[model samples]
Target: MKKFALYSLFAMASFSSLAHAESVLSFGVDPTFPPFESKTANGNLVGFDIDLGNAICQHLKMKCVWVETAYDSIIPALDAKKFDAVLSAMSINEKRKAQVDFSDMLYNTPSVLVAKKGSNLQPTVDSLKGKTIGVAQGTTQEAYAKGEWQGKGVDVVSYQNQDFVNQDLISGRVDATLTDSATATAGFLNTPQGKDFAFSGKPLTDTHYLGEGAAIALRKGDADRVKMINSALAQMHKDGTYQMLEKKYFTFDVYNKKP
Candidate 1:
């Protein structure tokens, strides 16, 4: 019957739609770092990295799923298939490259030492000889401080998250905190609580510890995913989507010029 034929065609179309449903890309993020990725009071994730990831997903026509994970263990979680990639403002360096692949550069910023105004503290070991410095655990800042200052009489304290490090710094528990210059400016120095703090020394340029810039971290051997992300990123750059997002969070260019 004609009615039966119509029903059959409709069912087939529904099946096809289900079979071709949009794929999903899950990104792991540690929401402790603000102006990058952090949770709102309403539990919504918002930041430049979140915006970037969402844009990539939109370009790829995939659903975006954000997985909250600690920064220290995000790599392990990615390896365990807990997420497809990490978009948590992770720096791409030889050390991290050994464990995972990374997309093209996202943004680059320098690391600086933040201390009370007029503290006259430099990042040098001699200046901080008897002082305490706070650093986020599993970050390049922690590695740099521990390697260069810890054994040289500078007490380097490691906090689980950057927020904790900032809190301790405000409480005077730590003489200073080493963190990204942009974050120090936006998340701390710009706030009323940070009114008395200022960057102590010049930006640290030891690529051995600081790495080059931030990028999306993917699981090792996930070349397909990496390629897909790179393609989307290229399109974003070509269409000025990247610059649009960058302007939303930063006044200066976070995407450093390539050599």
Candidate 2:
């Protein structure tokens, strides 16, 4: 009887594992945001989030589909059930939490300032005092910049996209721009404009604003979906897969970190 029971338990465990492997889920993001999510010149959708999303799908033995949406509309679209979840590098925060659930954190990059190299202004908040600062609208960087810098009477310029914000800064229409430190480092530093620009100092983050890190956004009450995503993410973390991707895109480790 003991041997029979042991065999039965093993069979049940195997079946459970198989069941977990069969679950399918869909993901959404803005494909134009490079390094995170974007369409390759080859017309293939590729980015950090896309890679990670596919990883989750692989773990779940699920089919993964890409649904492109505007960066600002991602969360709202998720709430509208436009997709099963979001992997667009949306930062988890209180305001966002009220509308959607989140998976285990995938990355935690900090926000940094970018300015023309010849500008006397620094990237620090004080440097922007009374001067204009540009940020992509509907982002955590925008939240922090407007709350901290704009509240100080520093001019806060909100743009629909980072590329445009970068353009305005380059054209001298904006004094400085606030963006993800890693992105500013990656996108800006690699290009001529980035080389010509520099960070004011380091980046800043508080739990209230930056949150613990970035995660997959899901509609509220989707506990099952959230659980599946978190499971896949945790596995990635334990297996060193997330680390590999992080290193591939960013030299610095941004996973499960404070800043």
Candidate 3:
């Protein structure tokens, strides 16, 4: 009789765990990058990525739970099963591919150098040499700056988030910053705090550093979930759901250029 009771408890616990996992789809996001992910004055998480994530969940018939995570720790947290997937504005690069699998490209945008308006700084090693540039830590921008510009007499500074990078730039602590063009425009340039800043030079496109563009990052071997997300995304595009969500935030076609 005691043996039967032990087996019953084990089976019940296992079923409960599976049940909880299927009830909700958790997505990890760092709400510091505006236009993609950011919190409002009331502490509600709202942004382009947040809406898109919810749409993906709706298509899958699952409840969406947003997990607030720091940008630098998102991947490690994902691997620890802290969340089912990461919806942060994480670029799908070669270095990241070794750590986690990615869904199809979510959207493609370019990296740009933001500096004081009329600074006349070009996005090149020689032009930025001996200048202090800030970038969010643990991002492709930081990797590119450190790897390509650090050796060329550039002083690259790493910050925890994009807002901090913008802060330092506004305060004159850094000569410039490297960030996503669309994000810089929507999150900073169009805002009051970023009035004096503008993108310098042209948009940067490096396959190795920037990867194939942003996508939904998942753990390796989560093939089933990946397929579900990709399929839902394709349908969203076909059914005009993507356009509706996109026009709510951006006026231009963010999906025009694919990587």
TM-score, one value per model: 0.90, 0.86, 0.91
**Pairs clashing within candidate 3:** none
Clashes of 3: 0
Candidate 3: regions farther than 4 A off: 1-21
How many angstroms is residue 175 displaced in model 3 relative to the true structure, after the best TM-score fit? 0.4
Error of 1 at 208 (Å): 0.9
Q: Over the stretch 82-168, how does candidate 2's per-residue lDDT look in tens digits? A: 788888878888988887888888888877777877676765567778788888877888888877777776989888888888888
Write candidate 1's Cα lDDT for 1-259 as tens digits.
Answer: 9999997787555534532463888999999877898898999999999999999988877889999998888899999999999999798778999999999999998899999999999999999999999999889889899989998899999999999998999999999999988888778888899999999988896787888899999988876678678878999999999999999998898999421
Q: By TM-score, how accurate is candidate 1?
A: 0.90
lDDT of 3 by residue, 138-254 (tens): 888999889889978999999999999988998999999999888998889999889988999988889689767889999998876776778779989999999998898887888
